[model samples]
Target: MVKVTYEIVPHDGGWAYKLGDVYSETFASHDEALEAVRIVVQEQQVGDEPVEISYQDESGKWREEYSDGGDRPEVEIIDRFRPGEASV
Candidate 1:
């Protein structure tokens, strides 16, 4: 069982969505990541990728994170944009 870390990061232009990151090495295939995201999104009722979720950690601090499948897309670099402006 590979554990993938999904992060819901803020989009500089459009709305945020689920993004997946691999957390474990148990599964070596991309399909595993996709399956995990499909299940999590369905169960969590998230409508889009990079879904935002809040959870309490051992220290009682609330943490927010976004997660998704590992096989979806690749981000070559971070980007920033003003509202209503076309992405450059």
Candidate 2:
């Protein structure tokens, strides 16, 4: 199964969670960021019927394929910050 990681980090004078090179909206506090990630995690676990999908990959090629909605990737969150440590 594919494993996806969301990492919390400092962004734009606030906090945000990022997957790969993409980031969510910045939050005013780390707790808010954590809450947002939790909500997304819950949503990602819901399953549906298999369906056809299409997308352009990094190589700039458009591809189409069928995806088993139940084949969702294992998702995780990584927060490097400790209570009193500097933010990353």
Candidate 3:
């Protein structure tokens, strides 16, 4: 996991993140931040699954079934993953 710092800024009508990639979100408040992170992580995780599932067909042939319920996963609090670093 790559560590990154996100900047939260006041946008046109609300708070936004200057660096939200596939793993982070920006907010004006702690509550909003928490919610956004939760949602982003869940959504991403559901989007990262392999698209095709293969299995043996009737003729012993491999068949593929499309998987539609997976998503890419994201990480939060990069510092949490720092080596030899403890977060309190």
Each prediction's whole-model lDDT (CA) = 0.41, 0.85, 0.48
Predicted structure with the largest TM-score when compared to the true one:
2
Q: Model 1: what TM-score?
A: 0.26
By TM-score, the candidates rank as 2, 3, 1
Of models 1 and 3, which has the larger lDDT? Answer: 3
Give TM per candidate.
0.26, 0.77, 0.33
Q: Residues 1-88, candidate 1, lDDT per residue (tens digit)? A: 3333353334333233243542322333334434444455455443355566889999999999776533243222112322332111
Q: Which stretches of candidate 3 lie over 4 Å from their true place?
A: 1-26, 48-74, 78-88
- State in Å the error of residue 60, model 1: 8.9
Clashing pairs in 3: 44-72, 45-72, 46-70, 46-71, 47-70, 47-71, 47-72, 48-71, 48-72
Q: Across residues 1-88, which tens digit of lDDT does each residue of candidate 3 receive?
A: 3343444345545544445643233455644654564454455555454577889988999888886654333344322323442211
- For candidate 1, the clash count comes to 13
